[model samples]
Target: MRLRRHSLPEPRIQSKHTGMLQRFYNDVVLALGHGCGSSHLAGWRRCPPALTIICALTLGLSCKVHAQAAGNDADNANNTPAAPTCLPDGSGSLKARLSGAVQAELVWGNEGTECTGAVRPDGGIRVRFSHKDGVDGGRLVLLFGIAALREGQSAKALPVNVTVIREGLGEFYSTQGDNKCTLDEVRQEPLVGIPHRSRSYRIIARGFCTHPARAVRGNGVILLPRFDYVGRIDFDAEDKDETLEGGAMTAQGRMKQQ
Candidate 1:
């Protein structure tokens, strides 16, 4: 028996889909910038850039289908915008099953509890994890306080986590943690911040007793620095003087991974 040489089949090129595919690619590009909520995506005239990106990605991928009818169905679904459904707060908790829409998937420990309280321009937010009193074994809970910002401005300005103590309480504040988060850009004309003008925020993660809790018993404070944001953090003493700025007035910085 003799072995025969065989040529491999050439890759299929779909000429009819060329024009359609190019348009699809453009949509993907637009969606990428928006999905990440980059500063460049925020502009006048349009739906949220992030949402636009989701639609583009869905359509682009669906167009890969060899069957024209199937591809068209996918494309139509991507192009159709679902009715608006709002979350209590515009956190990443919103979910829509449409082919194209803004969405997020959170894994445990990765997505901490989003605290209900927030810090003011002059103040901050306090988060508490409840525990049973006198319990030798206890579980620690983690929470996240996301900062809200202008459509594009949200991506700018590094977020810093500072620990501010008042008498006996610790408070945490985020750059975008407040009612300011819910403000509508289309309805509200806001001031643009000057570059390099940064605000320091404080976030307090404290553990307290919930079972018959009274008189601040069995309470402890765990200060995790640099809760969120991507940038450099400085953990240093506010003052060199050993007299005034001891552990009480002393400040320290910790790095938070993005």
Candidate 2:
């Protein structure tokens, strides 16, 4: 008479857990059959009690370890912080309505935009705005010739030199040899979270052009009836001292006094 081989019934559960459990069952059944010289369920009934207990313990331990590893992976993913973005707080912007040669409502914001300002050696402040990695983009520059500016202070009707450059197109100046645009009002405020020693101030300004900016080498003109922007300026020790002194001296006067 030939002995018929018997296979273990598969677990009712259908998932990765079930697959793992099935593998463990197969291993145990193989070991029991080897010890009893029969690859069938009858061999399991004939195996020693200690051997069956050992197989059961091993399967439980493996499943527990796998579950712990999966839990650790999930916890690590949850604890990771998100990446930081550029200019997340919308601290910088430039908005304006243009007419004449360049006619468009220009709105540049913190995204992909860079604005920088510094104190000129002559006590002037120059602010520039441009696009990041923009080889063929537009650029705006504002020049303020004030001797000193302070936080929470406002200046009005100040003469400002404006320059707009459109790469591959042309360059326009408020006045080639004169002032055609005036800052209607500009207010300065201390930027929070910055160290006092850094001497950086946020400036918000609105201005308009009495005449259009004529192209340097062309007959083109870009008219801006109104424009506004938020920018920053870094000042030095000398500039700070000038602001503290409450002196209404012109840039040239300060130079002469020095």
Candidate 3:
């Protein structure tokens, strides 16, 4: 008795999506005997169950890999760092006029400007104002050696040193050896709306130079007749030598003065 040969019907893909993954799935199906010449249907008929299971698993794994790649791209975008900005609060400003060798009027506000202050280990204060344009634009530094300053307290006629630096000009100090400028009025108060572990205060000061700041390297002088600013100081700022012993001569001497 002669047996008649029968061929299985070709597998059907219903989805019309033409993505790379879809094409890859179609290739995988064809490689598994969907279309491998006249005997293709015969091979699929022999192992339809096994080939169907493999196609399902391959589609699932491809989808998972694509989803994982998309997730990684999103995470990389989120990890990018933000750019630095000026202080948001409207509490920082510096205004001053320079004359003599260097003549220019300087004004800095919270926009495109930054102010920082720290209390030195010797109980002095250092405040700096930097503009977005860098030193060429303008930079001012004030040093106060009035020992310990208390909140809500005001002082007058104290020795204060000033430094001015700008582009096209060299650094200028109030005096080569001694403070030639005076802090006519200075007041301190707690800064509001900011949380800090250590004591922080807003320092407001106005002053004038008794003698112009002489250039560090040249025979130029910058006379700042009047200047004022609003700055901040943190008492617990780190010092140069963090391990100064209590019995250290400098520490003891400061204690004795206190």
Maximum-lDDT candidate: 2
Q: Can you give the TM-score per candidate against the true fold?
A: 0.18, 0.50, 0.56
Q: Give the TM-score of candidate 3.
A: 0.56
Candidates' lDDT values, in order?
Answer: 0.28, 0.61, 0.60
| lDDT tens readout by residue for model 3, 1-258 | 222223433435454423545566556655555443325345556876667776797778778877878998999999966533234456777888878766767787766566666665655666666554443654444333344355346788777766655533434343532367787889877765444544677778988887876555456777888988887766667345322211122433454577
Give stretches of model 3 more than 4 Å off: 1-88, 133-152, 167-172, 176-179, 192-198, 238-258
Per TM-score, the best of the predicted structures is 3
Query: Which ranges of candidate 1 are over 4 A from the true structure?
Result: 1-114, 121-155, 162-258
What's the candidate order when arranged by decreasing TM-score? 3, 2, 1
Residue-level lDDT tens digits of model 1 in 48-134: 655665667667656664577787788998996543321222221211111111111212121232222223232222222221112
lDDT of 3 at 96: 85
**How well is each residue in 44-105 modelled by candidate 2, as lDDT tens digits?**
56767746686677777677868888998999989975532223367788888878866777
